[model samples]
Target: MIPLTEEQQMLQAMVRRMAREKLKPRAAEIDNTGEFPWDIVELFRENGLFGIHFPEEYGGSGGGVVDLCLAVEEVAQGCSDAAVILAGQALGSKLILLSGSEEQKRKYLPRIASGEFIPAFALTEPGAGSDNVSMQSRAVRDGDYYVINGRKIFITHADVADIFTLFAKTDPEKKARGISAFIINKGTPGLGIGKIEKKMAHKGNHACEVILEDVRVPRENLVGAEGEGFMEAMKILTTSRPVTAARAVGLAQVALDEAVAYAKTRVQFGQPIAKFQGIQFMLADMAIKVEAARQLVYNAAFLADRDYKSKEAQRASSMAKCFATDTAMQVTCDAVQVFGGYGYMREYPVERLMREAKVTQIVEGTNQVQRVVIARALLED
Candidate 1:
């Protein structure tokens, strides 16, 4: 383990304790009910986890990206969905801290960090998922305010968020360059929520679609300059990807732990199944992949938080996200296999964990997109 400061070490221990005590035991209930785990979110907020990646002045603990990533891994070790819920606060706060000005910081960050305000960064649209620049949302200047129209799909916390950090285009012809970020209140007129999506995983994170039909936004609500949204979003993703990667590592580790523990007790051929060469090899691979993924996640997180001189930080972030999520899928699947026919039963938690593992490879830019990002970075340099 990397040596941490006294406070950092304490924070890690606290997260592990909370995860085991609070999140792990309730994972089944959350999955079965498919409701937002507001209680768990409240626990995180009370624990000062909401503003983890921001400065202390903003009601945060002054922790950086890597510290927050460590926190995410611990939370996910118990429940991946809860970890993702925690990520909404971390990721949303990161976007504003990176792109918003001092005034915006003072106005928004503190409330968010304190959990007085729940923030949502709305970017993805039904048509614009991987290609974020293709966003059709428009922000038309109307005197002192800009009227925003169009919709965003698959936005985390769209239905329940108090504030939405939104993306829209001021100049359609400029495409990506024209895109600008804005902060719109949830109660604003003409802003509405569409259907809440029922997803295969992360049901507790509560993803939904947001509709802004001529929604009025003050000039002051603009996050950064027009034509800067794409870059701003990229900046957030470059750092946030590692958090997702870390969460994936946590999921893989849990799967491995569950599999190993089961293998030690379950009987097969009059011996523990763990004695078999096949089971041993599977466990070995699971352990290796999880540790490797953790390293990549930490490396990327370190570079982002420390503002490292390494030129490859973005690529490292993409690599970590891609590799770690892939490991989650493979390891979770193998974990189920290790359980034999019993793994398929509802009595086992591996099935739920396996379902949760599939999404990590798809979100925060798909693994295929990560390869493209890695290639583009390498070629550009």
Candidate 2:
């Protein structure tokens, strides 16, 4: 348990109240209808939830990564999908803050902080996922602009995002070094939104393919140096991983809470199931794992707030993301077991949580990638 500042604590309390009073009541409807949570987004904006981590000069609250994670965890407790709306905003804006020039930041970061802009990150393509080196997207320098041509898949918030932080290959023969990042507005010429994927979990969370057919972007929109996109992405992931871990922890805690609450009232053999040692043991294990994961996530976020580019921070983020999300999958499954048959039913929140837990392992660079990162860091040291 890391001690939060008074301001952070107050922010957490406000988010928790919002989650319980607002998001929890709508979680089921959002899942069932598969509709974007625009109302929730409006709520967050009204409450000054966007861009909380950027500098105050940029219209942000002068907070840090830890502040972002604290808000995410509380929001996730009530609606896991809704939490993504907040975390995803950070994911979309991270590159700009880390690698964008002063002119770029001054132009965009303030809009982000003011909730006047909704951003999406476009990186993954049909041919490139974990192996970003295999990217096929091309960006040819034209007169005063770069013409980009490629298709980006699994782009979160793409359909509705006001702007995109996109990546393309500026010098194909250079492979990874060839990659370049850009900031392209949504309505840019030759930019098109493709099929919207109906995900297994996080149902209403919007993600789709973004097609760039000779999209022309101003040279000024290039983020950082032309050949530094890959490194910039790595830096973004270093901080973003812990945010995902915090989401995993929050979801796991909700599962544990639901399981414990159900166990106490569920009657079996003329007694409450919580009275049985088997159920008690499961509850205890779930509680332990969730707490442990939470601590790791908090520690990772703290390290990120202190230093975003250090090797230590990268390693911690990878470890925390890997362990916490894995814990989420295990704890959510056990939560279902605690509910017995009812757990499998849609009427119970544990079943939904179980499904949600599975995706955390797959997203944010996958647990497998995290282990590779952790191993390489360990071996290098």
Please give the lDDT score at residue 49 for candidate 1.
Answer: 88
| Global lDDT of each candidate | 0.87, 0.91
Per-residue lDDT of candidate 1, residues 1-381 (tens digit)? 456778888888999999999999988888888888889878987898887777888778888878888899999999988998878777776767887889999998999988878888788999999898888999999999999999998888777789998889999899888999998887999999997888887777778889999899999888788788777788678788889988889999999999999999999789999999998999998999999998889888887776632457778889999999999999999999999998888699888888998988887798999999899888887
Residue runs of model 1 more than 4 Å from their true location after superposition: 308-311
How many steric clashes between backbone atoms does each model show? 0, 0
Off by over 4 Å in 2: none
The TM-score between candidate 1 and the true structure equals 0.97
Q: Per-residue lDDT tens digits of candidate 2, residues 1-381? A: 789899999999999999999999988888899898999888988998996899988889999888998999889999998988999899999999989999999999998877778899899989888888788889999999999999999999998899999999999888888899999998999999999998888888888999999999999999989978877898878889888899999999999999999998999899999999989999999999999999999998988888878988989999999999999999999999999999999998998988888988987788999999999989998
Worst 10 residues of 2 by lDDT: 227-236
TM-score, one value per model? 0.97, 0.99
Overall local distance difference test of candidate 2: 0.91
Give the CA lDDT, 0 to 100, for residue 191 in model 1. 96
